[model samples]
Target: MRIVDRAGASTAGCILHGAVLLASLDGGRVYLLNGPAGSAIAVYRLARELSAFDFPRGLGR
Candidate 1:
């Protein structure tokens, strides 16, 4: 499925910040839902654009 989050923060700055934030959650911790789907998709979209992203296993498991 083409995961498309068309709501929430969708700006470059927001995306970058989101990536940094998510990356920091690299140990399987309870990530409090801080924002909406767009905020979350920002990182995922950035990852795909860069072609060098992977959600570490055991994350949010």
Candidate 2:
């Protein structure tokens, strides 16, 4: 999936195994939360950087 900020910036990546939460806050910012059961929860700032590789080989499948 792709997440975009209000400034017209975007990032693309896949959620291999997780529950994603997206929220748009004040300013031109966006928040992306990734929760994967027992693993660590990840919080990302949208439009900061794009995914280098969306999915490689058999990954994210």
Candidate 3:
């Protein structure tokens, strides 16, 4: 898949744990945790586009 729009904050870091993908941006102030399908192909397709935001510290697990 390709990125259709080139807008938004730059990605700072990314980590994959099992099926979950954690993406950090804006100097780690913002993050996006995505859990796509278990399969590789399905994950790739679902990751085409995702939104990120600052997760509340109190809400973290």
Candidate 4:
């Protein structure tokens, strides 16, 4: 599945692992609580995508 921001931005890059034990979105930041180490691949990918947004702006972080 492809992740998406409130603005409908494509956050699919954030999906680090297929397992995705846990995941949450903190404003502009997408928090993946627990997942396999291999998920790091998606972390960086998300970082690149999220960089465009002002993370933690909403969700009352």
RMSD of each: 12.3, 8.5, 9.7, 10.8
After superposing candidate 3 on the true structure, give the runs of residues whose Cα lies further than 4 Å from its correct spot: 1-38, 53-61
Query: Which pairs in model 1 have colliding backbones?
Result: none
Candidate topping lDDT:
4
Candidate 4: segments with Cα more than 4 A from true spot: 1-37, 58-61
Ranking by lDDT: 4, 1, 2, 3
Per-model TM against the reference? 0.29, 0.27, 0.24, 0.28
- Name the weakest run of 10 consecutive residues (lDDT summed) in model 2: 17-26
RMSD of 4: 10.8
Q: RMSD of candidate 3 to the true fold?
A: 9.7
TM-score attained by model 4: 0.28
**Candidate topping TM-score:** 1
lDDT of each: 0.38, 0.34, 0.30, 0.41
Clashes of each: 0, 0, 0, 2
Residues 1-61, model 4: lDDT tens digits: 3444466564344353211311344333344445666465565454454423334542123
Error of 1 at 34 (Å): 0.6
User: Better model by TM-score, 1 or 4?
Assistant: 1
lDDT winner between 1 and 2, please give it: 1
* lDDT score for residue 45 of model 1: 47
